[model samples]
Target: MRITKTLWNKASAARLLLYKRDASPPSNAVRVLGAMLGLQFDFEEPDLLQMEHRTPEYRKINPMATIPVLKDGDFTLAESHAINLYLLSKYGGEQKEVLYPSDLKTRAVIDQCLFFDAGMLFRRLLEVSQPAFIGKIDSASSTHIRNIEEGYGIVETYLESSPYVAGDRLTLADISLGCTVAGLEGINIQ
Candidate 1:
């Protein structure tokens, strides 16, 4: 009975970890980490078309109404970059060092890459997308286009130095940037 209880608790924790209130790469980043770590997920995707994210209850989970709100037990986390670090640290176990290394220099480089994605790359995506979401424009404006291209240039510069976004190996920064890049490509961002 004691062992069974322990198994149950572990299973419960994983289930809670898998609980995804919103969808997208930010959320997908966490899911990818979980998947790579061999954890089972229970995705609870909300309908964005119907404004499901703006509901009162949904707002309780994330007042900002952001995608990929992760609910683990009683703890809720927002922001893809933050969640990636938290999940990687808490559940990464043996794989933590591989994904997010411990050395300060390596970790600092990784942190810089993540920051680039969140502040520059991902924000550029949002700038081009929000206007479309509200029907303010049919597509990205010239300035938005320039901004997107500028973001691509930044990524290119990062790769010119190393194979990965952070260093020689993959890291949380790559996961977050990959998702944002995919979204841009899906819209034919060139």
Candidate 2:
């Protein structure tokens, strides 16, 4: 992704806030998409270990107090998947058509991929992470490992038919799912 002068200028002027860090897969996805769109965002890192997300102010912005919150002016949105979709729909021009197509069937497939990431891949990851973070477990259980491997198996099957997750071209689905896989890798979950 080459950053053009126009993109740089637009990014400099945009007022966007992304509450995220590199350690989080969903956060990483949104950051990549924002960069692709030439959108600059003020990053606010909420320390989960420090309980910063539990603060009253942060909770007001997001009741769930999750990371990767997007604040565009007065409008605030939670969840990285939704934020990615919103960013593409609002700022993506004709040049970004491959990232998100307008055709109903194609879009539906992309949507399904997004849901799969959220419901299956990320959900299984959370099962492993949540326990470790709260000191419930020192390592991933056999069940947790099996679930993640199954998720990857599904992704492997999907890739057999297309160069990317959803189709031949890169889409928001790839961004979303890629981040989740990257997160798992970062922790040496395999």
Candidate 3:
């Protein structure tokens, strides 16, 4: 829980659009941001904006109509990945080296994992698990099970190689996949 010393010391206003869940992926993003910036999040679970990204009022904050929008001072950002990176770069010091990396080759490996999580791993999990979470998709269906299984197999294969997804040292990639993918285990997906 060692957050950024300078970031914690600075007085800043922070707000996030998110839901209530222990393992909510966005919360992990916020947690990572807090760790990166060393600042406590002024979290607000705005009911009016809850999943109402298309509303005109909400569009002012993020025209893309995305959840987990972040507002700090005059700046606003959307996309958890982008926000996490921004926080780390702008506020983090030596710790940024661990999360984002300094070496080109090591950074590439982390980038690969982040890309896989955002582009493929998470997409598939959300597709199959969406139904299960919302009671729309039958969790026991062979197709649903297979989809989850396939995704899990892919992650497990990679995890078998390293203690974490991106390798020995934990990175943003682990934070992303760990919170999102690991939650699927509730339905025995893992």
Candidate 4:
């Protein structure tokens, strides 16, 4: 059933630390980072098949109606990318310098990879999955398949530049794309 309550607000009640309904790729990326940071989350499983994210309560946590809303203390943030970066910056402790170092040039490279993942790679994956998920098609079309190849071409270029997308050492960029690439593979991108 669709959530009809329109008066619910995030400000009224907020004690949740983390809300992840499943092991979706986006949430998994953050989960990987959280594991590296040795952090434990307060998980609550909800049926995505039932569209729980469309509920008023879930919307209060993430207006985008997405999974894996991070609520650490008074800070309530949505979006896995933002949540991952914030967690690394705030709670990374010693691992902060290694995973997401504050260096200028390295950080720029990491940022580039993140942007590429968010814009091109992830978008291409969505083109295929969204339609299939809604029963618009049985599988990805040739156009969507070509788009996925184009995304992989970009990945190839990044790998050619260095062993990792960001450089020698693994960074948050790799984690983001790792999850996205896994999604792409789910749609047979590879």
lDDT to native, each model: 0.76, 0.85, 0.67, 0.78
Order candidates by TM-score, high to low.
2, 1, 4, 3
Give each model's clash number: 0, 0, 2, 0
Show where candidate 3 strays beyond 4 Å.
Answer: 1-23, 46-51, 132-135, 138-140, 188-190
The deviation in Å at residue 43 for candidate 2 is 0.7
Q: Runs in model 4 with CA error above 4 Å?
A: 1-16, 21-23
Query: TM-score for every candidate vs. truth?
Result: 0.86, 0.90, 0.78, 0.85
Name the lDDT of candidate 2: 0.85
Query: What 10-residue stretch in candidate 1 is worst by lDDT?
Result: 4-13
The candidate scoring highest on lDDT is: 2
Worst 10 residues of 3 by lDDT: 12-21
Write one digit per residue (lDDT tens) for candidate 1, span 37-77. 76555577777767898899889988988777777778888
lDDT of 4 by residue, 1-190 (tens): 5532122222223333677744366788888887776666667765676888889988887888877788877889887889998888766778889988889999998889888887788888877776777678887778898888989999889899799988999999999999988887788532
State in Å the error of residue 151, model 1. Answer: 0.6
Cα misplacement distance, residue 94 of candidate 4 (Å): 1.3
Measure candidate 1: CA RMSD: 3.5
When 3 and 4 are scored with lDDT, the better candidate is 4
Clashing residue pairs found in predicted model 4: none
Tally clashes: model 3. 2
Q: Would you list the rank order by lDDT, best first?
A: 2, 4, 1, 3
Return the TM-score for candidate 2, rounded to 2 decimals. Answer: 0.90
